[model samples]
Target: RLPIKWMSPESINFRRFTTASDVWMFAVCMWEILSYGKQPFFWLENKDVIGVLERGDRLPKPDLCPPILYTLMTRCWDYDPSERPKFKDL
Candidate 1:
């Protein structure tokens, strides 16, 4: 099963998915890669993910993730879909 942590707030709350949502998922995939496939939000239960996301929380940078990469990830998770970087910009 895919981790709930990869779902964007819009996708979770309103069933909206778009390229911006794909950007969010890509960020989570990057986090997993940085952490050697470690699951995102491993400490949280699946049911709690949406609430945490609604609260504007996001996964912290992995210890080994480069600053630039983490910055890109955070941008991808921006609450406003329009604020996310285009895939070409990544």
Candidate 2:
């Protein structure tokens, strides 16, 4: 899920994982299940994940996924954590 503990420890210490991150993880998990345990970002390196995350980008979801679900998944990866939906809404 969201790595709340994986934040940077700077002087300002604005390090905190949010619900958005959790949603991202959930989407990743869904992808894994849909692919039957196939690797995610297998073709991409770890840095790619970081880059996409930093840029508020998400993995290209499967076309079979319903549009509603896909939209929710993308919302989970929102750059602004506050813009993310809550668990209840998810």
**Number of the predicted model whose lDDT against the real structure is largest:** 1
lDDT of each: 0.89, 0.58
Clashing pairs in 2: none
Candidate closest to the true structure, highest TM-score: 1
**On residues 1-90, what C-alpha lDDT tens digit does candidate 2 reach at each position?**
433222211201354445555655676677666666767667765434565456555666775777787788777656666676788987
Q: TM-score, each model?
A: 0.91, 0.68
Cα deviation at 54, candidate 2, in Å, is: 2.7
Q: Give the TM-score of candidate 2.
A: 0.68
User: What is the TM-score of candidate 1?
Assistant: 0.91
Q: Per-residue alpha-carbon lDDT of model 1 for 1-90, expressed as tens digits? A: 745678988888787989999999999999899999888889999889998887889999999888988988999999999999999988
